[model samples]
Structures are given as structure tokens and as C-alpha cells.
Target: MSRIEKFCAAFPDGDAERIEEMLHGYLWDSISVRDTAVRKNMKEKFYHGMVLGLLQSRSDWLVRSNAETGEGYSDILVYMPDKTGIVIELKYADDGNLQ
Candidate 1:
């Protein structure tokens, strides 16, 4: 079975804590801080690609990057088959130019 199918099956009642833990673990285990800074100037696109690659592994989830909303673009958008969608925003923590 696909990863998404297995995930849904494992959490038949949609356990939010388990799902969050799984995602957190995946981010910690699969992505490396060193691997994220391969170039001199890392842009949001780079981070987006990293996250997109991870989400794409789930055969049942549809992932979109920089999707336009009514106000602005969302950094990452995840659509589940039978549940609410997920919207993710990426920002530089040290950047002081946020509005």
C-alpha cells in the first residue's frame, strides 16, 4: 500500500497528535540542515523544493507550491482526499522586513 494509504489506515480515526508527530519526525529524520544550505544564497524556492519532495512521496496527497489565494500566494498547499487542506507559509526567521 502507498504511504498515504497506510497512514490513513493506521490512523483510522484521524489522530491529530499522531499525524503531527509523524510529520515532525519526518522533517527531523529525513531533512538535514546541512543539506538545506547547498548554495550560497538559499531562496524560498529551495526550501519549497525540499518540502515538496518529501510530501510527494505520499501517493494520496496532492501538493502545490506558491499557490495563489485571494490575498497572496501560499508557500505550500496540501490537499487531502477527505479532510481539510493544509496551507504552509515560509519565512526567514531573522529577516526583519516582514509586514
Candidate 2:
């Protein structure tokens, strides 16, 4: 198994692809993140991926999950690279209380 695959196995509830997407976000965000070490690592990998065309500056992708699992709202939300806005609305409202 790939190194990422092995790491992801520990997060059985997480999709490997989703983790990649989050990593992509972490690598590409315009603002600097707090940790220098992690930033350096991700930046190197991201640049390599970009050089090889594995990732692009603007790509349409979304990380979403809706199921009985405790994943909750989108862990990462990505807009289409085309800059089109997609709307999500609730047909019903939830009470402030959680069981």
C-alpha cells in the first residue's frame, strides 16, 4: 500500500481522496499556516505535484459527505475552478438541541 493509503487506514471513516483534497487545500491556501514544518513539507509536495501536472492552480473539486456517520458538515468545501457559485439550502430547520 502507498504511504498515504497506510496513513489513511487509521482514519477508516475518512476517504483517502478526501484527505488528498484537504491536503491540496492546505498546500494551496493563500495565507500562511502557523506551522513552518508542516507548511514546508506540504509546499514541497504540492510544488512537485504541480510541476508534474498532478494538481492545477484552479481545479473544480468538492469535499463533502452526508450520511448517518458523525462526519458532520463539510470538512473542506471547494468551489469549482470556474468560479460558479453553488447554493445549498435546508428544506427543514434543526432545533438548537442535539440528542
Minimum summed lDDT over a 10-residue window in model 2 is located at 85-94
Error of 2 at 9 (Å): 12
lDDT of 2 by residue, 1-99 (tens): 654444333233446566456555645663355433454335444343332232222234432322222445422233454564222212211342324
Candidate 1 wrong stretches, greater than 4 Å: 1-41, 94-99
TM-score of 2: 0.21
User: Best-fitting candidate, measured by TM-score?
Assistant: 1
TM-scores, one per candidate: 0.54, 0.21
Q: In candidate 2, which residue pairs clash? A: none
CA shift at 55, candidate 2, in angstroms?
23
Highest-lDDT candidate: 1
| Backbone-clash count (model 2) | 0
